[model samples]
Target: MKIKVINKGHHALPEYQTELSAGLDLRAVLSESKVLAPLERVLVPTGLYIELPQGYEAQVRPRSGLAFKHGLSVLNAPGTIDADYRGEIGVLLVNLSNEQFEVKDGERVAQLVIAKHETVEWEPVETLSDTERGAGGYGSTGKK
Candidate 1:
């Protein structure tokens, strides 16, 4: 799938790190370093704009290494970018550790995964079919 994008930052466009990667890394577009104190959250811009086709969305997610190493993660995990939005891509980053973290210009902070979705139509019904589990959730099945 092809997407139209505009990059105003100094770094190259977001791309997958490997051949089989599902997400593309997004970088911070800051002129200087920005500090995030412990438990602080901020919106970090990527200076990237994209036009996605209908029935598709761009999901912004956190990098695993950053989360495990620095306790930094996307405040809204898997943040959704609608197909109609045409604004700069910003990531909501939060510091979960007890120390401050510095975000530098063009630093890889988050990732973008383009996904295809479906919209469901409402169907009025009197009753629904039942299952053995039947709406059981949140550890309903005992762990072995």
Candidate 2:
């Protein structure tokens, strides 16, 4: 439940008031920004470090405000933070907006959620069991 931040930024670390907070918080590095087209994706850096407890993982997710307002989002939605990754946390952000997005320093870029996971051994199965519609994807259950 404790995260370590490396550098001091223009803004404070983003915290969660609820039980599920994806990322602690981070600042944006926008001086050398990339130009993107409408709906294009760019890698946005989140300058933060993390120290997660064992058996828990951090998921890099997009902030709802950014997504709804400017179509900005995390490129690798739900990016994973491995338990052993003792490195600075960076977010891979993308501009899903039509126009070029200017992300200033200390912007609330994304959210981080701490989750519990299990390390499992892979066991091969001979045959898979069938269901009503097994492995049917992409709106197999008619669009609403």
lDDT of 1: 0.96
Residues 7-126 of candidate 1: C-alpha lDDT, one tens digit per residue = 998899998999999999999999889999999999999999999999999999999999999999999999999999999999999999999999999889999999999999999999
- Candidate 2 overall lDDT versus native: 0.73
- Model 2: runs farther than 4 Å from truth? 3-10, 17-25, 29-42, 142-144
- Largest TM-score belongs to which candidate? 1
Model 1: residues with Cα > 4 Å off, grouped in runs: none
Worst ten-residue run, lDDT, model 1?
135-144
- How displaced is residue 19 in candidate 2, in Å? 7.6
Q: Each candidate: what lDDT?
A: 0.96, 0.73
Q: Which residue pairs collide, candidate 1?
A: none
